[model samples]
Target: MGWFFAFFFLSGFCSILYELVWLRLTMAQFGVTTALTSIVLSMFMTGLGLGSWGAGVLTRRYGQRVGFPSLRLYALAEFLIGCSSLAVPAELAWGHRLLQSMTAQNAYSSGSYYLASGLLVAIILLPWCTCMGATFPLAMAAIRSRQRLESKRSFSFLYLANVIGAVAGAIAPLFLIELYGFSGTMRVGTVCNVIIAVSAFALTLGGRASARSSAPVLTPGERRAVTAQPKVLLVLLFMTGLVTMGMEVIWIRLFTPYAGPVVYSFAFILISYLAATFVGSFVYRRFNTGGEVDPYLSWVLLAFLGLLSLLTSDPRFPLNTPLRVLLGVGPFAGWIGYLTPMLVDRWAAGDPDRAGRAYAVNVLGCILGPLLSGFVLLPLVGERAAMLLFVVPWMGMAFLPSRRQEALPGTRMGTRIAAYASVVAALALFFTTKNFETLFPDREVLRDSTATVIATGNGMHKRLLTNGIGITQLTPITKMMAHLTLASLPQPPRNALVICFGMGTTYKSVMSWGIPATVVELIPSVPRLFTFYHPDGATLLASPLSHLVIDDGRRYMERMPEKYDAIIIDPPPPVRAAGSSLLYSKEFYAVAKERLQPGGILAQWLPFGDEAVQSSVARALEQSFTYVRVFRPVEENGWHFLASMQPITERSADDLVRRMPAEAVSDMMAWGPAATPTEQFDRMMRTDLTTQKLINRSPDTPPLQDDRPVNEYDMLRHWTHYVHSGMRNWKPDQYGAGSNPPPAGESAQKGNE
Candidate 1:
């Protein structure tokens, strides 16, 4: 029994590690759109469901006649899963290459692209995920054959250990990836799986009985009971899976603002959820004495808990981020943790086939939940209302009329009262609570499948926020991003490209050069909200000179054939944002180099980061470009990295101003603290920084790469610095006064305007 627990604990750890790594790898290969993310996750769950059901069928038909111990089959499954760690990366790379070739031959629409990429991903991932799903039933069969009494609650026992292991997995991989790259981290998972397989196989070889199970020959009464279990149990399991996973997607969107957009923010949410779930499952295992919990009361509690996030997430509330996540998500996730295995155990009755079927039904709901949330609910109703809709099912289930046989005597009135009270509380929360958008009286809010965008503030204070995190503001800094790089060229740019269209400021500035400017924005709603920030936004957007492509910037560059004289990349803020490394990585620079014409410049806007991140990004640029120049923005504390394959001339302020056209000069001074174009150019030039100076801050730090996102996974480094600084009473002011700089756009003072 101890060995089974250990086996499952390690198995669960490996499963989550694979999920995190694979999802990231697929995003790198495919585009990083919401739809692509949903497809990858759904395919993963689908594979698990198919494997569980198929394994159950095989066990039911052949368990009694098998010549070897069932544990050997479990070991074989683990061995295959371990091998996947090596195979999957190569397979994904091949699929990406194939898609690229197809894309080149035919101009694929967005729908066609998704279809082709999703099919390729499903083909690559399904087999390995199936092997992951089969572990449950195979282990259950082994336990049933060896120990009859333990088999009765084998599912819950394994579930508890798995959840515990999952909690560790949620926190461990961040540090692992920080030390090793993605492929190296995967190698660690492979080694653990191999150890589990070797240990399981050795146990089977040590004279374990190969006997057919005596418990398979069921009596007539037992057979009737097994066949007659209520189908509603399956429905309940499905609902739990759907609601829990859906809420997770919503939580990320709602909490990102308060927690900041770093990778640690996501890890904190997952840790809270999995840790609380472990407690619930542990309590269930300790207390399960063949007694049933009250279904009506449980449903009522879940329905109310489902709305707890509304109160905690409200801007009017005083809770901090960690408190908000814990109070909002903990109780609801814990209740689900308690309910899921209980229903599965009751329905399965120690039969591997029945448990497999029940578990697969749950996984089916898991597969659909994120898709429904990302595609349908979030885009249509937004986060607050979508959460309200998720609660409706649980509320309805709580009020469901009970059959006479199932109803407990004298408890009906209390259950009814609790159910009514929960509905009232949910309604109250819906009516009174204020979301992040409501914090500003003057704001335009828009929702799309990708993000929730809010254009808020007035005059120079105007800002663009996606999913509540402020992206960019109306400032001259954005204008300089276009003019400074374009004017530095000895010859005028023929055409240009802007990667991120935040508030359309840079895109608008680029157009002032009177060249064809193309802007690629990830969020569709962000482009639509341009008119909210600038009065001439609609006019600019309607002009023939402007072209808007709503897609991931890296992906757009990969597929598009047109080369630009200047490519300006202002990746979304915070500098340590999850997936931001993709833009700053060495591989990304290699791609950008391919898209630049001879003597073209690539200007990268890095809002803010610590020494390690700054050094890593600086090193990447230094290695990628022949000539690289770094400048501190005149108004804000951040870098503007200008890199070019050709020599970037060090022109004087007057020379730079002379290079710009009349319209470009006017646009540069439109929102400036400077009185003239030469003054504006001079102010920027005064802050010129060298790439070598930036890299010298952390010489040991390697260049940021696609495989190793040093900026995103810096929790361990930050922690170590915090401890040493505290001991020495040091005031770390390299980037700012505190351990973390103020979130990108927030750092600039209003006086700067």
Candidate 2:
């Protein structure tokens, strides 16, 4: 019995570890878009739901009639789970190769590619995910036979262990990935599964002769006597599952902007959710009443969650304090988490078949929730409102009439009227609420699966906002990215790749060169907003030599077959943004280096504000290339890293002007500090930084990687420095900027005005 408890704990731990690593792997293979994330989550839940249902049917029909012990079946399921762990990573790699090959066939459509990839992901995850579901039923059967406790009570013990293990799962990656990387961590999970399988088999060996013979434990009359209206209970549980899972998606979107879109943000949300759930389930076990809950109290609690969620998710509210961590996200997670496992625990009544049956229905609800939240709700209403509106289902579920209603719901005229009034008041307050969205007017809003893009400005200038955080505005410094890289290359560039397409500034400048240029952008809405900022954006996009593709920057480089003379990347601001480290990782630089032609120049934009991040990125770039040089693009806090295999030499603006093509020279002068190459060259000469010295600035600082993203997960270390010292920004004072000072420039700042 003790061994079985340990096995369940280990199973829960490995389950979460696999989920985190698999999601990372999938994102690396496919672009990180809303549609892709939703598809992956839905497929995972669907496998679990089906597995639960199939196991229940088989247990009731065959195992009940023979001398089969459920412990043996449980052992078999654990072994199968272990077996699938070995195949998951291999299958993902093969899928990437297959998808890349099929992309070459012009006869196949992009839709077909997406469909095939999704199907492949589903096939890879199904076996392992299904076996995960079967463990619950099989374990319950063994517990019920060996122990003399109520079947309902045993479920709570196992659930508590599982949720506790999940807390470890959410947190282990921060350290594990830093030590082992993604592949090594997956291997660790595989070993844990083997231990779980072995423990289960050992238990089976001891009980081989003592296995329960096939016999109907509970007659129909007995089952009906225990509970009434099974279908209604199932429906209520389904709605419970739906609201809880859907709200997670909505809350993640709501908080990303404030949380800097880092891995810690997602990890914090999930950890708090599971931690709260563990507490909720533990409380349920202590307060067990052996009866259906009073339906009147349930409705009131559900209604309360609806109202509280509004305050919790609103940005205008003062939720930035440290306590905001608990106050902001815990309300909805606590209430919903408490009610779900208890509902399943109560409905199944200690019977393994009935337990599996009810839990399967709940898992199916989880399958659809993320899909609807990501695709339909977020795109239509935005994150805050979408989060508030989804609570309507819980309200409906609570209002549902129970067979035996306690507390006299809808009994007295005044009570019923007052209840209805309160519900209306909550909805009205949420609807007319003055959040950041409702308070600000006259802003252009665009929504898609990836993000909510808001455009705002005054008079002649404009700014782009993604999920309420300022991404960037129209700026001339962006032009330096295009012209400087082209002019500095040993040979005149024939073609280029721009990783981020912001306001079409870089792309437009690249297009002016009259060479083939492909711009890869992650957010679909970002590219669509191009024309609003640049009137000539449509014209430039129509050029035969220009192309815009929506893709993840790293994945694009990996799957790309062609080489380019120059590859320039301008990632979105606040380097710590979730998944942003992928663009700065040493592994990514290696891939980009391999894709660059001989004498090719790869330019990376590093935004200053965090020295820790700067040190990590600089180290990654220095490690990847043989020769590297850094230059401050303007007087601002950002630097451009120029790297290549070939030796790089400095040249004056006059020297560049003498070699520049007539049209190329015109493009260079169109948007920078200088009207001629000589003027631009003078400003660049003042700000050149030695790459090796910068790498040594923070010695032994770890470089960012896919698994251990130093930038994404190290907020605590960085914030500690921010709290005590008066430093809000990482100043460049340590390394002097001016060798030969250029006079104050106003053309760029004036245009920004």
Candidate 3:
């Protein structure tokens, strides 16, 4: 039992690691702008479900009839899983290439391309993930044969080890990412798989795994114990799998804003969930040894307490507020954690045949859950409403007494009614404490497969949040972004590509140039929401010259090499958000450089939220571009980094204004403190910095890399160090490397406001 525990533990860890990285890799290929995440997850779970059934059949028919031990088969499954770690990366890279080729065809829209890529990913991942499912059954069969463990004990001990390993697999990558990049992490997973195979092979040499003959058929007493209420048990298992998996999807969305959109954000929630689940299962292993199980009423009470934990979690709680965040997320984590493994233990009873078949049924429900949440629940009712919907069924489920519970006729009606009212009171608390949509204004909420887009405020005051993170806003600050970079160019710019369509401000400003423009936005809903921000959004969306593309900025550039005069990258803010690292990586700049025409410029927006982030951005820009210039976008704390392979000449404010197309000048002044174009240009010129000089001050500043993402991970450190001690605004040295940067000139003041 000890040896088998170790063997399964290692395999469980490798399985999660592979699943985590592969999912990220596939999302990159297919574009995770829709419910594509749900598709990939569903497909992976579907493979697991099918594989469990197939493994049971193979073990029953061949292992017993052919006179071979199932433990040896477990060894082979581990080897195959090991082999898959190598194949997966290569296959995903190829799929990305295929997606690139397919995107060039005018016949296909972005939606169809995503669908095709999804199919390719499914084909690549299903085989390895299916092999993952086989481990549970094979190990169970081997343990049962040894007679060192009974049906109940076998599943509990094995489940405990698997989940413990799963907790590690889910979290280790976040720390490993700084040491080893995406490819490096995948290699680490392959190594773990190899360890599992070797360990399992050792187990085959002795112990119950060594048994080659089939055991006698179960006696009447054992048969009855295993078969009792099999139908109800299966149904309960399915419901748990479905509800938990569906809520996991919702939880990821719920927690993203609190954790930031960083790569590790999802891992934090997963770790919390698995950790809590391990606690529950561990508790069950200790207490649930006998044939008797806790009644459903007790489980219902726990569920109510869990709902309280979730209801208290403010949806818009700042990521930096740890206590509030933990309080908010704790409830859901506690509820599912206790119920899942406990229920599985009861249904399977450690019988290899029953365990394998029953676990497969649960996995199928997991497959459906994500699809149901992403496509049906999320899109139809929105996040808050969906959460409320989950509570209704959960509370209702607890009210119905299980078959095991025998109540004297009508004796406990008052007690039951009070219990029901308590559940309703918790629901009422969640509703009265509503309106955490502070991430954006309360104008309109739009839900799609990709994200829930919310628009708030009115006219140019509107803000946007794709999911719960503040994405973009309608403001003149955005207008200045287009004019500042374009005006800085020494030569006339004829074409431009706006990488992110944030409130369509930069895109609209570019169109004001009246030149050919291309706007590439990742989320489709964001582009569609432009009308709510800008009055003329409809005209710009319909413009022949303004080409709006629903594709990833990086992927779009990869598909088409430098074909524009200038490209402005206005990525979503806080600089530490997930996927932000990819945009800031040195490699992306290399890709962007290929598409620029001669003397072309790439303007990047950097919200100087932290010193590390500011330095990291500067370092990356320095590494990529020959001539890099940094400007203070506002008098307070934002920056604009203009980088160009072509030398950037510093023209006087009047001279630059003279070169602007008449319409471009009009766009700059349209929403500014300045009454005229010259005044707006003067505001941009007041805060220029010699980029090389600023880089000199931060000689030891580390650059943001694909592997070591300094921007995304530093917030954890910041939350601890700066939050405790008052955070100081660490401004870089003087504009000319004088160790003191003068404040933005008074002339730029009105415009900044």
Candidate 4:
């Protein structure tokens, strides 16, 4: 039993690792967007469901002798998973580089890129994902065959072990990712696979040692015999699996939009699910074991929980944290605890020989839940509302005839009424708590007639968490220095581009200057509903001067045809989004340079008070552009960068301000270095350093484009900077003991504001 659980847990881990990295690799390699990634995952999930069902059929016909051969099958599957993963990165890199070398003059032919990438994904992932889907159910059958139990115990124990394994799998990846990069993780997974196969094979050998037949357990005759089933039990299990699978998939998908970029919401969701499953098994054992009550009611309750949990979709959903926690831990445990044991017992039929079939069916049910959700439900209503619709299954579950009613010695109307009232009360609270408006301040309360509320976090205490990284606090008066800096730039710079539209501050700033600007933001919600919180948000969203493009900035620039006079990369630092690091990469700068007209400037905000980070980033940027110049708005704070395609001739601070557009010039003279009377302003530009050559060379570093990719040096750069910043109270404006002092310049002050 212990060995079975161990192998099962390890198998779960391998499956998740394979699934996660496979999707990430596909996206990076082939540019498979979120929508397509969802499809691929759904397909794998569907396969698992089918595999589970198939395993059951295979087990019953073959008798209890299938476990020994199943171990070998498990080993082979692991080998396939490991080998495929190792081979993929190399293949993709080779193909991509080969294409680049061939198309030196033209970048890449779109047809060739898609063809090679698609072929690569199919070759590497399709078979592996399929194999992963097939493993769990078959393995469950093997374990169950070894553990002879009563009908109910058969299914219950199998699910219990599988969930335990899932818990183990869910926790290992975090440490694994840190210990080994993606490729290393795959290798480790391969090793884990080998271990599981060995253990399972040993178990099979032991189980068979005392038996009659030793050759692969399931013979041709036995395979044919497994077809007979209790139709009622199979139907019930299938429906239960299908509904649960669909709900899980839908819930997981829906989380992508609301879950912050860095939070690893899917992993969190999976972990919670496994945890819940484990808890549910224990809870079920304690409360409902020994056939005390009909298992159907418990399942119905769980199905209901899965269905009604969709109310957490609102952006203003106040209890996102608690809701997410529940989403993770609740339904999975509830369903398993209340529903799965009954299915197990039914299949086991008070016999240990049939335990494998029961376990296989339970696993099949789990896979089916996600498969149906992704392929059938998600496509129909989209991820969000589809989750809400899961309620239909729950409500339907409630209609199932309770065996308790038929078998109970006595039933009182008063007791039934009291139970009904309690259930209603619990459900009412669930609905009310989940509703966004009920949890957070209403739009009307936040509407300030005096000052246009620029942007408020959607929920009470709702911090703007992008990709799981927190960006800003949700206080009424959020800091506007960053936005104001962009806004205060000179008016009508001919053409301008801004990336990262937090609160639409940069957009408003550009509009104020009357510059025709394009904003590229990856999140869909930002541009669509920016004005809902702030009047300026609407104006910016509605601006004719503003063109909004939903894309990664690096991607947008690589394909952009027109050149801009000023490109403002107001990326929310590496703090908010890991993807932001790509913006700071040398390849990114190269793309930025291509989009700039001659003498045009690219202004980037680098949060580097630390000299090392500043130096490394400066070195990386210096590799791409020319005339890298930095300006400090005040002593020990506010570092702004202005880089150009052409050299920027040295000029007095006042003269430079005067040459700029009126708004920018006014800003420079006012709240800028000129405005801060107590602080000193300075210029930091390395004249001798060649910025262009710093980024472009290196046979090892791949040239970044819309298709080709680059290493994530920016994450390291940010970490390095953060470490140094913590050590030193590093201020951008103030020069240090060893640092160069501010450039000497006496300029005529203009009270432009």
Candidate 5:
């Protein structure tokens, strides 16, 4: 029993580690759209369901006839999962090359592209994930062969150990990824799987040739009676899987405003869910009586607890970020943990074949949950309404006849009263609470498959928010992103491209030059709200010179054939936002370099970051391009990095002004502290800082790359810094005691407006 517990604990850790690394690797190969993410996850779950059912059928047919050791089969499954750490990455890279080749010959439409990539991902991941699913049923069969009494509750025992390992996996892997890269982290997972495989094989060395079965083969009539009783229990298992996974997607969108969209925030949510689940499973194991809790009462409690998220997420509620997540998601997740394994135990009754089929049914529901939430529910109904829809199913199920024995006398009356009160409370929460978007007085809210976009505020203060996180506000710094890069070109610009269309200021400024300007935005709803920011937005969008592309900026550059004289990228704020590293990585720079005309400059906007992030980004650009320059916009406090293959020759403010057309010059001064183009450029020139100065700030930091997102995972470094130098005394922008100041007369204020 101890050996089985240890084996499952290690196996669970490897599972989560593979999931985190594989998801990131796929995003780098395929485009980083919501649809692509859903495809990857669904394919993974599909493989799990197929593997569980297949392993069960094989075991039930051959275990008694062949006299084979089930531990050997369990060991083989672990060995294959370990080997996937190497095979999966190589397969994904090959798929990427294949797609690129096919698109190069004949461009595929968006729907066709997803279909092609999804098939490729399914082929690459299914076989490996199938092996992962086989571990559970194979281990359960091994337990049944050796210890007959323990086999009756084997699923719950293994589930308790697996979930404990999952909680550790959620928190510990971030540090592993920080110290080693994604590939290196996968190597660590491979080692753990190998250890589990070798240990399991060792346990089989002294086993008997003919294993004793747990229960006698059932008669035909008894088999039918056993199967008939568990039909309702399997339905409950499927519903639990669907609602549990579906709400996880909604929780991320609803809590991003408070959590700030960092990797730690995601970890916090996962840890809260798994840790609470561990407590629930532990309680069930320790306190189980002969009579189980009534299924009807459990359903009623789940519905009531599920609605608590509305109260916790309301704008008027005054709770901290972590507390809000724990309170909102913890109770519901813990209840699910208690119900799932209990239902499986009741259905299987020590039979591995029945347990396998029941678990597979639940996994099938898990496959569709995220897809339904992301593509259908979120896009059509928004977050608050979507949450209510998930709760409705549980409320409906509470009225169904209970399959378990009737409760003792007097308990039925109390149960009905509790159910009525809970249903009333859930309805009250639905009508009373205000969603995050409704809290804004003047706002136009739009929902798409990608995100919930909000355009709010009055004139000159208009802002764009994606999923409740404030993305950008109206500002002159956006105008400078276009003008400064174009004017720095050695030759007159013929065309330009802008990635990330926030408030449409940069795109509008680029169009003032009368050159063809293309803007690529990830969210479809964001471009529709462009008219809310500028009165002339519709007029500009209608022009032949303006082109709007709805796609990921990095992926757009990879597939498109067009080259631009100037390419400007303004990533969303907070510098450490999850996936923001994709825009700043060296791999993205290499792709941008291939799409630039001669002397074309790439302007990267850094809203705000600490010295470590600044140095890592600077080092990546320095390695990718021959020449790089850094400038601080007069209207904003962050740096603007300009990189090009050809040297950017020095020019005075007057010379820069002479190069721009009359319309471009007029647009540059429209929202400026300087009344003239020359004065605006001169003010920008005064704040010029060297790229080397930034690199010197954090000499030991490595360049940012797709495999190593230093910005997203920095907790260890921050903790070490805090220990050596008190965090209260160290400010993020301060250069410490001896570091040189920014160019003379430059303001030291640290964030974008």
Candidate 6:
């Protein structure tokens, strides 16, 4: 019982720690956009597969030998895992910084950032990943040798214990990493390794005097291990692995927009697998010795139900309920865990000594499943389709024959009614909720449901209000706003361009100005989805004068040919995903200048943020262009900047007010708002104070790009800074909880004059 408790805790702790460290480094170094993170995760699986294959060789070569000490071996594996946690972070930081510097200098313009990120990721991942992968097999080998059992009872029982441990390990990271950051999570993991090493050593030292008797070796053919049932079981487990991998990626994709601090997001999955494993193992331990059909029958039923649930459930269902519940407490584990003993019973048959070999092959499937899913299914077909494809092998498990059959004794009448009702209910709900999000689209829609709008700019002309001031004219301009602004700009405006293409309002504005403008957007679904929700948006996107390129704004600027007299960066706030971080990076500024013609004006719109974020951005701009001046349009929350390669002076507040459209003139007449006080301008001027401080205090963490490492913490800090800055600048009834008002519904839209 002592040994059982020790192994269970150690196994769970070590596995979860390994994953937490692995995921953190992957997300940080590779930027959040790529699918390669999945490839790294699958390495742990590969390691398990290799570990399983090598276990037999290890046990046979060292089981009874004096030199091959099991206690020392266990300690060594734990130490390796500890060492991996530290080394992975350092390596990730180093490689990420190197790429950032190279890209910033234009030293590697020939290759895309994605390619560079991938190559750097490969160098860091391959070695540590392989080492991490080796632990599971080593663990299983240690367990089998310690027990040294002849009966199926001991083998099944010990294997069942290991399954529980694996499940526990899988679930631990979700909570630990959340409470503690990744660094703290790794520290917890190190302690787990030490405990495992110490306990194994203590157990071995106590049992040293009792050497097990050697059993006669058996050949593969002599054992009659080539049974059809176990083979079917193996296939079922492997298919489950595929589903598990696909589910993980799909879940992340679905959750990314709504959730923050999503590291422990896979907890549901871990828990579900754990529950299934516990139930399956417990049943097998109770009934396998008696050759009762109940154990095998339960496994079949669980797998069938799990697969059937998946097939009938809508992939884009509004809620993550079914997926989360099944992931935490479903048949995923029943498939992965039950197969191990079933294969052992077949291959080892009556010979307990050869059972180690059967267990190793079972571990191999764990490694292969994720790798195949990441590199093949995920990138080729979307996550939704990959999940649908998992059902084929799971259904095949029904036909396998076994020594016992445990059929339910239910009458035909009861079974028929349940089955019929299930079919009708599933079909009815599937179609009913398919575009359910259109009813209410906002932050709440994302918070409570799975419905994601591909293009938000389309449906309504959402005003971009900052600090209680509207900047609608600064973003998607209407024909009236564009016509007015273009008539006002100094002539030779034939080559005007826009950095953001929100709802094509700015494009309409630019077209009215008679300048051919190009717009860049990151999300591919945005243009199309917006077209569905907003009819006007569809026409603007297909407009003759505008070209909408689905590319990062900074990347597009680096390669674009037009030398525009005016380039409007009417971008959405930095609060959205990676968009905010990319905007502040020095690399982006360098590219922004390269696209601008001499004496060209660059307009940047910014929201209120803390000293750090605001100043960091100001410093970034200062570093890029010679003339950087801040502007506060007459409206509230309307902060703007006109930067240039040439020196420029700020115009008087009265002149700025005078140079407005009629509505803006009307608003100015109505409000008669005071100019920003001298104190506020001084605060704005202090934006350069912390640029050097930030650079010095920051660890040499690389600047984020499509290929750069993503620092979720760093980005979160940026948001926090933004929030604080907003609070500092807040006036009564301006941007806040209930005190400030919400935007009126889509209709009576007043253009940000």
**Best candidate (score: TM-score):** 1
At residue 731, candidate 5 shows an lDDT of 55
Model 6: lDDT to the true structure: 0.48
What are the RMSD figures for all models against the true structure? 2.8, 5.2, 5.3, 9.5, 3.8, 9.3
What's the true lDDT of residue 458 in model 4?
51
lDDT of each: 0.83, 0.70, 0.69, 0.50, 0.82, 0.48
TM-score of each: 0.95, 0.87, 0.86, 0.65, 0.94, 0.61
Better of 2 and 5 by lDDT: 5
- Any residue pairs clashing in model 3, and if so which? 261-578, 262-578, 313-328, 441-456, 562-594, 562-595, 734-740, 734-741
Cα deviation at 744, candidate 4, in Å, is 29
lDDT of candidate 1 over 1-753, digit per residue (tens): 898899989988988889999998888888788888888898889988998898888778877664635788889999999998899999998998898788677666667787888899999999999998888888888887775576777888888888888887777799999999899989988998999899988887774633355556345776677678777788878988898899899998888778877777888899899888888787778787573544576776677798888889898888888999999889998888887888778778667788889899999989878888888999999998899888898777655665632632233777678778888887887788878888878999899888999988888778888888878777788899999989977588999999999899999999999999999999999989888888899999999998999888887887767899999999887677788889999988988998999999999988667778889999999999999999877676678999999999998999998888999998898877788778777877887888999899989999999898987887678778878777455332222210223433344432121
Candidate 5 residues 1-63, lDDT tens each? Answer: 898899888888888888888988888888788888888888788888888888888778876
Give the candidate number with the greatest lDDT: 1
Give the clash count for model 1: 0
Q: What is the lDDT of residue 626 in candidate 4?
A: 62
